[model samples]
Target: MKVLKFLSVLVVFAIIGFSYWIYSSLNAPHAHSKTNQYIQIPQGSSTGQILVKLAAEGILSSPLPLKVYLKITGSGNEMQAGEYLFDSPITPLEVLGELNNGRLRTVKLTIPEGFTRFDIAKRIAKQFPQNPPEGENAVLNLMEDISLIKDIAPEAKNLEGYMYPNTYDFQRTVTTRAILEKMVGEFKKIWKPEYADRALQLKMTPHKIITIASLIETESRLDEERAIVASVIYNRLSKGMPLGIDQTAVYIAKMENRWDGIIHKSDLESNSPYNTRKIVGLPPGPISSISESSIKAALYPATTNYIYYVLNVEKNDKSHRFYSTAAEFERGKAAYQAWLKKERR
Candidate 1:
């Protein structure tokens, strides 16, 4: 009888213990199941508020289990506030892990070669709102206030040509100054000491070389023809002839926001110092963003006495035919004009 009674008591104790284990396991809070869901913890929310919000979002099965687990794991105080995307069926533990790790999506901004600072600023404004004011004029004003490129070119009114074009990864909250600094730093890295010496050897300052390079960049898109174009500019300077580049007139028109894609006769006759057709020397400032190859070409032009070049209409390979005199250039220009008319027709 005594043995049977002892066996019954042991069986009851075992049953009680098993029941308690099952209850604890079922009530334990866990991450939500893997499904597409957003878990947001607003800024300035307290730990308790965050836990409550998580529970209400169905990410936590039970707030008590989550609270206890957090306290036990010492992760209750490590939650960060941000917008988080949770994969479906994620557990509370997984959410906690993500929060602790501070994971956020990154945005990419690509600045192509020969992009002006105005273009770059527009790109930044689209990607990062924390950036400075919008539009080319507003961005130019902000750049002047920052003095980013003033030391390099004290005469420059804006950092238009200095903003090297490249791909950049930034957070949504990144500032304009930070983005500009990265681009300028990249430019500096590419601008070697030897290049500076070469500029001096050519009787030009780094600033002047950059300014001329910008003009060459705007004139030609063919990398192989940059040196030839550079020679044209140099030849014109040596002969005291006006460069007569129409892009300069376009730039002047853009400054006044009066550009209409058509260069008016009066625009060529404008008294602006930037009017290369009216001026006998290089423009007072850069006309556009310059590539490294353009800069190199400006520093070391090809050994050619050819003073003029026109688009090669027959080839259409982005190559230009050079001529030492006006007659040959006129022939090339006539061919180009015929081709343009045919295309338009």
Candidate 2:
């Protein structure tokens, strides 16, 4: 009787100890060096393989206890595969939940309203570099593949104004091609049917409207004044006068890969068709990315007789003063010149 009682008590204590071990091991949090980065789990990996891999990666201090716990619970069979970003001090149970849900790690890529393809290339290169370290020029070459937007703007030389400006979330392992496709896809989505109809009424192609929109985007940061700026552009074009937009000279400098952050006299004198100072009407193509508001302003310019605009020094908000006559324009130009001189000092 005594031996039987001792044996029963020992068995009970052993079970209790085993239960505690399982609970503690499954619930205790563990962190690793790769907590900040993405860990890719290739497709068709077995649960056991995943545990072992996690153990190797320090995400699991030891997989034995979790394996036993899963076996006891008949779990771990529903684990899915994908790129995962595990948080620091995450418990094994939490990691398992993440795997079961297949929650992917995403990174945000934001394209500002007026970023050029070159600027985008630099951002992409910095954020999502290729395994072999792709250069900015290599990324720029990808934008040159205009086949993506051939249906929308068949005459487009490259994807300058078609990449919609917005914040996009992509998987950490997303390719540059995928990012470019998404941006262009977004642009296509926002190019409303009404815009096309309006373009027809204006006797302008979608490409031309986007080109004008790009100019407006670079010329004015104020959405309210973009239409007025667009009117100045249209007014100049109607009178067969040069656009004289300094941003076009800057764009020319960028195209030539000699942009020194300042528009020089040589840039203004450049004979490139993109130089608005030298060529009449719109540039050969867009000089920068376009925004929806700019596109709208381009399609529906405010009715005005304005032909010239200079920076409004009084407003101090980067707004421009519009003028209908050369005399009025010259006075505004003088104020802008004085402001520029003061700024330089």
Candidate 3:
């Protein structure tokens, strides 16, 4: 009996020691030289394989502790595959948690509001260039495939205004097509059933609404000014007056691959249908990507007789002065031109 009791006491002490070691291994922070290194675990890698790979990469001090913990906790199958960035002085348990949660590293791409397709293509090419190093034109060609938005906008020539402008995270190996698809998908999500009904009420197609939204987006950054700008656009359209937005001229220059950052006199005189100075209605399609606020403004414009607007130089805030008559518009235009000349000097 005495021998048996001694043996039981030894076993108890052994268990306590083993538990303490496991606890220390799992919970103790380990400092590694490889900080901020992105480690990718390919698809279908087993839990054991992941642990070994992480151990080799110094993310794990030793794989045995995590392996034992997983076995004990029956969590060995919870490990997921993805690109991971492990910080220095990380605990094994924390590493396991990250792997289990699939917190994959991603590349952040931001498409600002009012970014034209040309701007988008250039940005994408710079950030996520293809293996053979395709230029912006090649990326732009990818956008020409309009099949992604066929149902929502059958008349759309390309995915210009359809690519929702927002910051998005994608895998490092993300294809340009996949990125474009994701953006168009986000746009579809915001294009609600009620919006379609509203379009019907206004006797405008989705394409037309997006075009108006794009114009409004480029014209104003203020939420208050968007509806007012929409009113100006609508009022002008009703009176058969030319939209005369200079951004359209800029868009024309861009399409011809000659946007020189300065709108030349020749640009304003261009016969391109996109030149709102020459065209009576909305552009053939959206010149830039639309934002939600701009879309809302287009759907519900403020009731006003204002048919013209010029930059409000008095406020110095990027706001505009609206006018109902040619005389009022000319006076506002003169003030704006004066301000522009002063700023240039």
Candidate 4:
């Protein structure tokens, strides 16, 4: 009787211990990272292989219990292959659910309006470390595939101005080429057929319209003032005067990869076709990403003869004072210089 009782007590303790372990496996958080972590299960990986990878990634502390849980729930065979994001301190059940549901891991990448291809390249390089990692130059070369814009910009040297700026959703495994294509696709949605007609009426190529729009995009902060800025550009171009916008110098700096926020005298003097201060008419292409508002302004410039604009010092807004003559421009220039000097002091 004593031996039988001892055996029964042992069985009871064993059952309790097994039950506690199962509960812990189901309820306790398995992921060890302080931040969200990712575990990729390749296509056709077996349940055992998936568990082992989860263990290797430190997402699962002990694979045995989770493995048993998956098997018990008949979820083992349901685990699909893709990049899976695991929230830290997530329960094992949650991990299993995410994998079973085949929720693809996606990343949000925002390309701001007016960002150049140079800026876009750097951002892409940083955002995706390596689904076969690519460098900035490799991505830039990808942008040079002008086929994406062949219909709209047949003469485009590259896909610089056509990369529409907006928030984009990308699967973590998306290729670099695929990403650029999607962004260009977004731009197509905004580039209406009517806009192409407008461009023809203005005697501007679609590419040149986008280029001028890019100039207006970077020149003004307020939407209402973009038309005014576009008018200034048109007046300068009509009079056979240099567009002389300083941001073109910044654009030149970006293309050559030396952009440091300040325009260098060397940049102004360098005879790059993108440099508007030295070259008359539009740059070789769009200097930055173009927005639809700026595109509209380029298509229908306000009927103003004003050929110059200086920052409006009185309002301290990004708004500018439009001038029609050299004398008016000189006075505004002097005031701007005085303000700049005082600010520097």
Better of 1 and 3 by TM-score: 3
The window of 10 residues in a row where model 1 has the poorest summed lDDT is 25-34
Each candidate's clash count: 16, 0, 0, 0
Model 1 misplaced stretches (Cα beyond 4 Å): 1-46, 49-66, 77-83, 130-136
The 10 consecutive residues of candidate 4 with the worst lDDT sum are 30-39
Candidate 2 Cα misplacement greater than 4 A, ranges: 1-12, 30-38, 131-133
Best by lDDT: 3
Q: Compared with the true structure, what per-residue lDDT tens digits does model 3 show for residues 54-98?
A: 999988889999999999999988888888888789999999888
Compared with the true structure, model 4 gives a TM-score of 0.87
Candidate 1 CA-lDDT value: 0.77
Best-to-worst order by lDDT is 3, 2, 4, 1
TM values, all candidates = 0.81, 0.92, 0.83, 0.87
Model 2 scores what on Cα lDDT? 0.90
Question: How do all the candidates rank in terms of TM-score, highest first?
Answer: 2, 4, 3, 1
TM-score of 3: 0.83
Clashing pairs in 3: none
lDDT of 2 by residue, 1-345 (tens): 999999999999999998998899889988788877777888899879999999888888998887887887888788888988888899999888888899877779999999988888888888898523388888888888999998879999889999998999987778888889999999999899899889999999999999999999999999999999999999999999999988988888888899999989999899999988888888989988888999999999999999998888998999989999999999888888988899999
> Whose lDDT is higher: candidate 2's or candidate 4's?
2
Q: In order, what lDDT does every prediction score?
A: 0.77, 0.90, 0.91, 0.88
What tens-digit string does per-residue lDDT give for candidate 4 at 241-290? 99998888998888888988888899888898877888888888888898
**Of the candidates shown, which would achieve the greatest TM-score relative to the real structure?**
2
lDDT of 1 at 1: 100
Worst 10 residues of 2 by lDDT: 129-138
Model 1 steric clash total: 16
